[model samples]
Target chain A: QQQVKQSPQSLIVQKGGISIINCAYENTAFDYFPWYQQFPGKGPALLIAIRPDVSEKKEGRFTISFNKSAKQFSLHIMDSQPGDSATYFCAAVDTGFQKLVFGTGTRLLVSP
Target chain B: DTAVSQTPKYLVTQMGNDKSIKCEQNLGHDTMYWYKQDSKKFLKIMFSYNNKELIINETVPNRFSPKSPDKAHLNLHINSLELGDSAVYFCASSLRGESEAFFGQGTRLTVV
Candidate 1:
């Protein structure tokens, strides 16, 4: 129940197109969901996040669509660029447990 | 200034050797974490320290140990390293247990 499953282990999108990555969690105790972006040889960095209270959150070109009922969430990158090519990971945090569980990363390649 | 910094970006050692990875955060965050990313890019939490206190241990092997000298520093020491221990280790810090975390450039460990 602690797992956060992510889909499309690899994705290829053209520049100026939309890039989407999906994730689903089984634990309802998770109150916070965050997406992280990691470049080669670099650590994962926070890209955007959302809480269960809201259905969606958007930050500039990055957006997080969440569904509490389905226990699912997704990250959408608008106007995808080659610079956006990297590994994206979805994570859920259970405050009571005081730990964040991560999903298997999705390697996104935004082609030029 | 780097928010989170870890030493020895790359480590190559034999299976029977031991190694240590040092991590420090200038962010003054109360929570810190150690995460391991395998060859398949699967990220898993190894340990967590809050206020310099051990808070989370994810059933990792006894050979793996974490030490937090202070809130600003957390370190991982591996004894009797095995080939399976080869992975990219990341250090991260957060304001608290359920907040956005900042990660350092990972340390890639290769146990041959």
Candidate 2:
């Protein structure tokens, strides 16, 4: 019940195209959803986040689409670039618990 | 300045050895956490501390223990290292009750 399942373990997209990664959570208690980007040999870093109050949140070229009813969320990258190629992870957190439940990472590759 | 820093970026040890990973956060956050990323790239929360007090502990093995001497520092101590113990460990910090977490440059541990 604590799992956050992510799809497309690996994704390849052309530069200037759109890159999308999907994730679903089982626990309805999760109120906060965050996406993290991790380069090789580096720790995961916060990319964008959204709360149950909002359906979507956009930060620069990164956007997170959330659906509270479906218990699902996705990360969209506009104008995908090679620099954006990395492993992306989706995580859910119940603020009351103060711990994050992370999904299996998605390795994204943007071809030039 | 790095927001979260963990010592010994790479640690290679033999089986049955005991080791420790040190972590410190300069973000003045009241909550700190330790996450382990397995070979499958699944990140799992092992422990969490708020204001130097142990709060969340996942179903990790008893051989793994976490200590927080201060709010800014959280350390992990592992005893009887086994081959399965090899993985990349990350340290993160966040404000209490907030969802945004800052992570460190993970420590890669390889047990032979």
lDDT of 2 at B42: 89
Worst 10 residues of 1 chain A by lDDT: A93-102
Q: Per-model i-RMS in Å? A: 1.3, 0.7
Model 1 alpha-carbon drift over 4 Å, by segment: none
lDDT of 1 at A4: 98
Task: Please provide, for model 2 over A1-112, each residue's C-alpha lDDT reduced to its tens digit, 9 standing for 90 to 100.
Answer: 9999999899999999999999999898998999999999999999999998999999989999998889889999999999999999999998998879999999999999
**lDDT digits (tens) for residues B42-83 of candidate 2:** 899999999989899989999999999999999999999999
Per-candidate local distance difference test: 0.94, 0.95
Please state the error at residue B40 of candidate 2 in Å.
Answer: 1.4
Top of the candidates by DockQ: 2
